[model samples]
Target: MRVSGSGAGSMWLQLLLSLAALWLSDANEPGTAMTTRDINQQTRESISDYTVKGHDLSTSGSHLTTQDFKQQTEENISNLTSAVYSISIDGFSSAPVEENVILYSPANIALLCSLTGTSTDSATVNVTWKKDNERVESSNVTINETKNVLSTQYTLTIRDRNQMGNYTCVFKSDQEVKATFNLQVPQIEGKEHHVVSYVGDSVVLVCKSLKYTPINWIWYMSNGSDQVAVNDSLMPDKYIVDEKYANITKLKIMKISEKDDRSYWCQAVFKLGESKGKVSLKVLTYMTPLKPFLAIAAEVIILVAIIFLYEIYSKKKQMHAGTISCFFK
Candidate 1:
């Protein structure tokens, strides 16, 4: 078999071209090679039928169902809203001495307290309510026992200033456990808590309450980090406690010195607890406000003296020049 070289070369070239044509046909065929968009579309379709724990995924691939997500959101919002008006206390020991303080403003606000008992026997557990250590008679309290757990709830309404006091929840069982809620009015703060006065000047620090008439008014001065009670008997010439009215109390600081420049606290003792307001006293010399004017006046005097000296020097030079011209003539 004697084949020519040109014919063999031509046959090899035709075979290569035929193989390339077959590859190109297969690449263009439908569903043989997928574009990026086609692959993403198929992936989305397959994910739509997927399930986990018998719960179908949403169209957007979110695992939570519509109703479940909505209910969870509502429950979270409800919990946050109720937390503002309710207070919960639990885990009481045999000897409970810590008191929780709750401050309320001058408004008709109702406070809800939920108390849980730690006793195993719910049958022998009893709860009682007291205000300032006196028995409270009200129909707004409820007690429930479920699954050997004893719980009680008390609702107190503050309609007037006199109703603010210490509320105690006493749990009686094999041992008595008590928890106190010291309910008091918030301390009234004035527009200016700072008072500026000169040294050796008598200044009065005042604290007043419009709604509450405290049982007693006491004044304290800050000594370093501790508050020492201001006793008129001890420092008779310095401090004088005066009550202008039933609600207004004044502490007159006679001959206030630089050492008296500190925070003074005025505490109003009520039946429930004590509320204290802070008043800061700032002592300065009488020349403190005039310091800026004094600096300006000194600068003006120095400048005027400089201008006057320059004028005198100019006049002396002119007289010397006239005498030299006459000598030259």
Candidate 2:
């Protein structure tokens, strides 16, 4: 009777244990827990929401595993580089828990790339140019590991006039990731010319260019080889230009004389160029023969009238003297 009771208890216990095992096995099925993909998707959605609001989403995209977080962050870095912008690791994933950023003027250089995905606090970034395939420059930054993000800025100045190229940034955190961009400057061109006239006469020698470019204008006369007249006010031998829409330059002959019959030139100076033009001058010429002929005629008339008057006076004097003598006798 004792053995049968013991057997029956054992059987009951075994059946109960079997039933418990089945229940536990059902609970431990393979598809029961949420997958890494699901967590990553959720993190990305949440991160997107935070980014739209201009809020710090760097810490919001924390996935279940560090690998997923790092992978997502690297992908985001690639996208940011394509858009010419940078994103905090918090906006990407919650892995490594540390971040670094590089600010570049050219923004698309190798140094910028090396700085990406790494802590900015104590890392050296290598720089290179695509055309030259040569090393350009490098930089270092200090960063905190636990911090979700860190950043540094770099400015580039162009010193060469002929240098032409785009700037690129290569971001490198602990991972090997990168981004790129382009830079450009303006080109300049210029020229100048002028027209000039003498004083007391209206002149229209200078015509400014139609292109409204900023420039400096000057009026001058080219007297000799490489010689220019620079007097703004009229001098004894110089001409002053009047400020008018016509850009009239005048050469004043206070007393116009034969010496005033020289060519007057006008010169203009612009920002990056210069030019000059001259106008021929002529003095009022007098009739050489007419003046001398008139003078001779006047002299001959005066002499004839004088002679007639002298004879008349002498005859009257003689007659008076004779009459007086006769009376006296």
Candidate 3:
């Protein structure tokens, strides 16, 4: 599904023209108030003749979960990859499958799991999602349009260990169901660690979460706005995130600045949930190194000055006593 020749040229030209036309429309409008219908008309006119050669514009697959796009590779839409996905059948499964998820203790995070079956056969395919051997209602799951390949998504917003285990997506067409994905969020090992570093120095904050299998590692300041993830968009010389292994990811701050003195969190993203650790950064100002030495020198000088004054006072007292003795004699 590679685009070449006149088709590619036309597509590129149409894209550029559409962008330029939109920019002009916005620029020409005084109040920047283009109605929805007007904008729709403009878009229609911009690509009236534009067309793709081989792709069918009307066909669509699934209602892509956020994870799907995250997992999809950047390839031409025309090229189709082989269907190598797994589905976990409940008690009926012949063998055990491993689908373990590690969840971090945080709010507003969700777990997305999908069961898909792809076949070229004419037999219609369907899938049902179940938790602990009981049939789950459609309200709890999202089912995609059925065709040659059928898929369903199960999302868990609230995680409770008591209610977890043996969740499965049973496919109707497959006799031997695929693999397994466990739903337990493993516990994070060890305790919170404290790291201290100075300005002009580099420090790496290590984060080892449950089960070492992390899809993403995010670092953010503990300011109430810490929800946004830290990435290369931050100053390239200052912040970096490196993953040493499946369970270990570290946040390295380079050439620390005064603003770097703040609380940071290392959040690990997984299919089941997120796990995180806290790091406290204390950046010493440039003058901090000199304070100790300066204090010691000041103390010695003060002591020497006091000793000199006492010696002078003692000699004066002796001389006065001898003068009084001579006068009396």
Best by TM-score: 3
| Top candidate by lDDT | 1
Query: In model 3, what are the clashing residue pairs, if there are any?
Result: 97-180, 98-180, 99-180, 99-181, 99-182, 100-182, 104-274, 212-246, 212-247
**265 in model 3: Cα distance from truth in Å?**
0.3
Question: Worst ten-residue run, lDDT, model 1?
Answer: 78-87
- The sequence of per-residue lDDT tens digits that candidate 2 reaches over residues 196-285 is 334344333333323332233454544555545645554734444544543333343344455555555545443223445455655444
- Greater lDDT among 1 and 3 belongs to 1
Task: Report the C-alpha displacement of residue 64, candidate 1, in angstroms.
Answer: 61
Q: In candidate 1, what are the lDDT values of residues 1-329, reduced to their tens digit?
A: 86699999998999999999987897889768767898899988777655534557556666677788899966654443121244455645545544444554333334444445464566666788888889887897777766545656675434455877777767777677766666655565572398999998999998987776877888888999999999688699999999868688889999988999999998887654577888999999989989999999999999999999999999999999999999999
Candidate 1, superposed: residue stretches over 4 Å from native: 1-184, 313-329
Q: Report the C-alpha lDDT of model 3 over 154-245, residue by residue, as the tens digit.
A: 65443344544556665555453434445555545543657777888998877776545667777777656646567666767777877657
Q: What is the lDDT of candidate 2?
A: 0.45
* Candidate 2 off by > 4 Å: 1-214, 222-226, 233-238, 246-253, 288-329
Model 3 scores a TM of 0.44
lDDT scores in order: 0.74, 0.45, 0.62
